[model samples]
Target chain A: MLLIRAIVRPEKKDEVLAELSSAGFNAATMVDVVGRGKQKGIRIGGMVYDEIPKTLILMVIPDDAKETVITMILSIAKTGTGGTFGDGKIFVSPVDEVYTISKGTAGL
Target chain B: MKEIMAVVRMKKTGATKKALVAAGVAGFTAVKVMGRGNLVTDPKAIEACKEKLLSMGMDEFSESWDTEKMVTSFLDGSRFFPRRLFTILVHDDDVPRVIEAIVTANKTEYGIGDGTIFVLPVSDAVRVRTGEAGEAAIW
Candidate 1:
């Protein structure tokens, strides 16, 4: 399995969730986080907001479907017409095993 | 080292923490989250739920409440179910001990939904304060 972690703008969370659900990817965990990217956060007027509020949506999907899922997320998670910094990032990593405590089963 | 990420019932957190600490596991990050696992959210499912809601005399926001947001919330609202996510990064040799601690604390033998534990491969870890990396950074 492959774990996909995406950090996105807070406001884009719902849209991302909705799109994912429609695409038949319903299992996920959501968390609120704060971080900065290459841009080092947002600067509006004169004040620099070094820490920005972001939502992290995490899911572990089958290895074969990695590209499709990532593409879907990137397509929906973009800020505007094209794209810009702090639009957030997606990290992909391999999951060695998954155990369902209730079922006492592994490789799930 | 491996990163053990578990999404378990919120009520089980305290015991799980105590167990891990007692087992000599150094640290973990815990976050409160709403998790939806394999729940059917197809259009048909949403429509049926909307109808059920309407039948229950919840027709005030007829149009607005029929949205995907409403259906999604209905499916995974915290008011109905809230869970805790715990991510523990530990040395490879310590994996079994940590897993045992979590399972024992959770008492998963009792029933289902005790939650899931995912073992992920970690390439490296870094400790900012001391500039340590790899297994040493975790401790």
Candidate 2:
């Protein structure tokens, strides 16, 4: 199984979730977050606001489904002109194990 | 008042529990989420997800999922929260402690799984499910 993690603009979170849900890939989780890009975030109006709000979404899926999910996130989280800062980021990795507490599939 | 939020990537297991206990925030509400990183610079990918959203009768928006399992806990209540979005609201006094716990647990050396953390301020929170007030709506 693979675990997919996504950090997206706060405003786009709902669109991402609704898209993921309609794709028939339910059973995921989401939370609100705050942070800055490696550039230490952006500067606007001389406010010097260090932290920017973001939405963190996570999900678990089979290896074969990885590309589907990745494509889904990118498709929903990109800008029309190539892309820009704070556009969002998606990361994919392997899961050592997944415990099915309800189904009692602890071995998985 | 300050609001804090955290996102951590950890191998889903007892290690997460241990890290939480060590950080002294063993009592956080957790929800599951999923996705992955499209490092290939595929501009259509995020849009594809947006199209998926549009098909579902939702606004089209872009997003990204990095490579790792991310678990996030919202310590302070926040408005604009929608269904299936896990939220938590803490009093002004608890913000610092929760933030500290999240930061400590998210460190690269501590999380057992590759972890990341982030914090954000909140204005208010409302529970559409029952119209609860204050932290009740978030918790």
Q: Considering every candidate listed, which one attains the maximal DockQ?
A: 1
Scored by TM against the true chain B, the candidates give 0.68, 0.37
Q: Candidates' TM-scores?
A: 0.76, 0.45
lDDT digits (tens) for residues A23-106 of candidate 2: 766545566777888778777888766688988876767789888888988888887768778877887766543433212222
Model 1 Cα lDDT, one tens digit per residue, A1-108: 989999988889888887787777767788888888888778899989988889998888889889888998899889778997878899998899887675656755
DockQ of 1: 0.59
lDDT by residue (B1-139, candidate 1, tens digit) is: 8999998888998988899899998689998987766554255535655567556644556665465456556644212257899999998999888887787778654344567789998889999999999889999
What are the per-residue Cα lDDT tens digits for candidate 2 across B33-131? 332211223334234434454445432342223111111111111112222211234556665555454444334422122222223345567778898
| Candidate 2 local distance difference test against the native | 0.52
Docking class of 2: incorrect
